[model samples]
Target: MPALQYWSFLVAIGVLVIAGGIFAGLTIGLMSLDETNLAILKLSGTVEEKAWAARIEPIRRNGHLLLVTLLLANTVINETLPVLMHSLKWDGYKAVLISTALIVVFGEIIPQAICARYGLQVGAFFAYPVRILIWVVYIIAYPIARLLDWILGHKHGVIYRRSELKELMALHGEDQEGPLTKDEVSVLRAVLELRDKSVLNVMTSLEHVFMLPLETKLDRPTMENIMKAGHSRVPIYASDRGCIIGVVLVKQLIINDPDDAIPLSDIKIRRLPRVTARIPLFEMLHVFEQGGSHMAVVYDSLPGQTEQPGESSRNGEALARIVQPTWTYASPRQADSSGGNVLGIVTLEDIIEELLGEEVRILGSTLRACVRVYMEITGRL
Candidate 1:
């Protein structure tokens, strides 16, 4: 080879080696960022990362096509390096040895390590060139890509299942120095799990709830009992204890005359939102958000029972027969006839407690009234 030709071939060999490395690095780096990862980065990543994700996503989405293109380009560049070295008047063995060392270290190892760490940034930077390369190899790559797609049934983006998400949260919780606190991780895990739970899982059974018969008088002793119960709302039942008609707010008793024997029926009750026991907590939460009563009467329908037209409320009793109500929130103005026997009372606090994964002692009207009464006696209120 002439003097100028020798130097030109040497430079060409150097260029080929560098090109091969970039192709090798991109195969691992760019392809490592699967479709799902790019989407998440596009949505919530940093400004730079978001831009990179957006630019790279179009190429990344066609996984098999991009994979074939990158691999083919790298092979050609690697093969060309030894040939160019042979042109520089180097012997076959010498050319092969030098090309192999150069391609392995500079082309494959270094580029791959760097690209693996900063794949998104590097891929975005070279996205235009990659697109052009894809076009250059379109004829060859398209057929192979289609074959792979046909065989493997196009790659679907992987997403974390609810159980997997919970496991991930648990793992994060175990990391003491992680951004998420243990409590936060617990709450996240609970949020993911809330859908699996039903009202039956967290409710105060009718027998255990502090309730009042509609016929009972709200006199001094009754007022004292109401204040001592520490419940924000008390279920009011008529005729049968199993037939809970509505709930009376403990705060309503503030206007009660201590000496007067007022009937509990005289106090207006907030109607309970009735829901089937099988309703998921997530849907139940939407019902609570719709306004009216946060507390719902959960009833289980008899086997083989389906929904009936129009709610049945004769007198003040909710129908003890099987009434399978739809997921819709029932009206709070009138008592909803639950077709089945009332199983339990589910309060808003119950759902909240489930979300927190801990028992939360909410300060009730009883505690507030006690504090106010003490303050009044001490002349502090």
Candidate 2:
């Protein structure tokens, strides 16, 4: 063959190889972008059935096409180069070595590595174009996708599973470089807390609660005596503390004269709301929001169930009912009422301290468990 025709053929093969390599790199880049988009869609709960199907179908088709095209281009170049070298009277071994080195280093490794690392960034910049391509392919592939969907009994769109969120949380925890900072760890722990914490975790036990007998006459000296003891609201029970009738605000008592005989029924606030010990803390927040009250009365504590059974039941039930109810105090009226009856008085400050203490205890236990598990797994325990 003529020198120019031979050189032309070699140049064409080189161009084809380079083109295939670029497409391969772009395919890898697109896959990375797809993963990121899926992550965002999952997190935001915005992955519509159509959109998710549309998002993935084109990538799959293009990826398949790209793989075949690259393989064919690679084979053609690999075969053509040796023939070209032989015809040119060049050493076939030398040409093969140089071409392999060039393709591996420049065409494959460096370009693909760059694309992989910055895939999402490049994908974002090219999103408009890629989206157009995806749309075009989606239209063409719709029939096949629909057929597959029908056969597999797979629905289109984003269906949220609890497991997905758990996996995401676990992935986030794993991605942190070192020990997470206090705030970061607190946030992650708080996410986990949504599932774990219940009303019993933060409530005050009934033993420590100050309650007033419902039959007790709202006599001057009696109210005065309770006030002197520094209780704000006192739970008014019909016969015993367990039979709570309502909560009485001491401030309401102050509004009456010291010597005045105030009727218990008139002074007492009716319709006191009570939360079950098993209620989740997050759900309990809504109760606090609607009640326009704080300081909930926690009922009976079952015997032998305390974390420290030896401790008095009094302290255990008191500790259990002290949840910090979630409420947005947009104005002064929404603020916690000071000086209330002590069916159980849990101040915002008290709740904060309790939560902080619980977090510390949980973190300590978690760390110890992790260490123990690790040691056992490594046979170093």
Candidate 3:
């Protein structure tokens, strides 16, 4: 009878160990999936990926409950076998040693290694059974899970503010989170900042921006002056330099007879879109894309007492520029009160450069030819 009881304990220990292995593997396997990968997998991936996604979905949704259940079940089995051995007249210390060795080897080491290394393969293999286990166990586990949920409160997902997201990217850039490298994070950060960029960030200020007056004859010297200003696009104003109306490409100078008696007004061109200084730069890019135009005029709001032009604002400060589109220094009498001030000039190239956070090399053939002509005439390198 004593021997019979000993054999019974041995069989019970073996069964408990196998059950413990399933619990251990399920815990590690289910948790190993990244939520993003799982989501992507569900949305039209390969057959194997879709299969794994389907298998893992339920366990992932009920993760907390599944985890707690697995832990509770393992704990019960581990403790019960040892107590059962002692009940069969085995010594306490021997029972403890045997149980610990078996649990550690079978319950943790073997199962964890298999799941960790071939998680998708082995995990998908057992996913259905593990899923069934959760459902069966959830009936018992839900009350405690609900009570804990009530006490702690559940968040559907992480919410980050723009500043917080920047900080997180900075942290990842430093390699605190591992996989992401600094350069990659920097690109990501630049993209995030694109939405926040205003026309003021990229537009050439009014001071340096080249504006051709309608009264000025379209002569070689005037064309040279506009080209030397290092801008591919120039604004044309009527009589006053402050009242810009249309934009012209430098290439137009190369194609046209600079000696033509045509007034600057006769030059065929598109009117510039007027954009507010504070509007998002991305919106400007989108419009240029949809409308197929390159240049925009940036206007400014009334300067606050604390915030001045060419300096930082106390609220959402911006970099300084020469012109405030739709804003002017002229008195009401001198400047047309109806005509909004030109804050600055922004080109498609400027927005592209801003998006990439680097200057895009767009050397014009006309600009180069003009430079070569000047170089040959002066005989300087």
Candidate number with greatest lDDT = 1
Query: What TM-score should be assigned to candidate 3?
Result: 0.74
Off by over 4 Å in 2: 1-14, 35-90, 125-181, 215-233, 250-264, 289-381
Model 1 over residues 287-362: C-alpha lDDT tens digits?
A: 6665566687877754444324233333222332222232232223334453578898898889999999887666
Where model 1 places Cα greater than 4 Å from the true spot, the runs are 89-93, 302-338, 363-371, 374-381
Candidate 2 or 1, higher TM-score:
1
State the C-alpha lDDT per candidate. Answer: 0.78, 0.51, 0.67
Question: Which scores better on lDDT, 2 or 3?
Answer: 3
| lDDT tens digits by residue: candidate 2, 1-381 | 787888886786577556545545655765554433545544664445335534444444344333333344445555665565566666777878876775777567876887797654444454455555445555444555466556664433345465575555566666657555555555555554544565566766667766666556666557546644455566666655556556666655655543456666556454354444554555445345445665555433322222332222233243344333222222111112222233343322234444454422443244445434543554434
Candidate 2 lDDT score relative to the true structure: 0.51
lDDT of 3 at 72: 75
Cα deviation in Å at residue 355, candidate 1? 0.9
Order of models, best lDDT first: 1, 3, 2
Global Cα RMSD, each model:
5.6, 15.1, 7.1
- Can you write out model 3's per-residue Cα lDDT over 235-284, one digit (the tens) per residue? 77775767776676666655555556356656665566566676566666
TM-score, cand. 1: 0.84
lDDT of 1: 0.78
Q: Which of 2 and 3 is the better model by TM-score?
A: 3
